[model samples]
Target: MQLALPGFEDYDRVCEGLQEKATKELIASYTDGREMNPSAVFICKTMINLSRNFDILNAKGRDTSRVMAQLLSWFQELEDKLPRASELKPEVAALLGEAKA
Candidate 1:
């Protein structure tokens, strides 16, 4: 069941559109070069953050399943470009650790 509200079909697009080089680098840095699914990792991280704020006024418990599907699609579309991402970007490792609360 798609939960995308009107005009919101692009949510997954934006989420998945996070730069491939950046996303893969971030994953590599965090995972220490272990191969991992970039889309799954990105979506999981985004959803984790989203879950924290879901009850906020603007978030209003938006349907996350729909968003996840979109992200996955984006990831699949970009899968081929992920291989060389490790050497192409360094900023991916610069993000602060996730909140520990």
Candidate 2:
């Protein structure tokens, strides 16, 4: 997700390219119009925000230790909150088993 965010600009617009604010909000399943992330959305938002500035700061010779730390932490949190489907094989198998039963 962190890798995709830099290229996609917004995680919500993964393949669709940059989109309108409403579109991103909708795609991210944001409600109350807030991007607080029921779990991972906010982390994505923070990563996007951090990535945008980190490069510029680094180029300017500004230390980005804190920003990098925060960004890395968010990435870890995002992974914990919403792991890839591949990483959830056991959970997926359990769910599939339940559905079949």
Best by TM-score: 2
Candidate 2 versus the native: TM-score? Answer: 0.50
What would the per-residue lDDT of candidate 1 be over residues 3-94, giving only the tens digit for each residue? 88899976754533233335455444545544557664665466434333332322554555654555455545444434444554456433
In model 2, state the lDDT of residue 75: 66
For candidate 1, the lDDT comes to 0.48
- Candidate 2 per-residue lDDT, tens place, 26-48, comes to 43552333324466666676666
Q: lDDT of model 1 at residue 32?
A: 57
Which ranges of candidate 2 are over 4 A from the true structure? 1-37, 89-101
TM-score of each: 0.26, 0.50
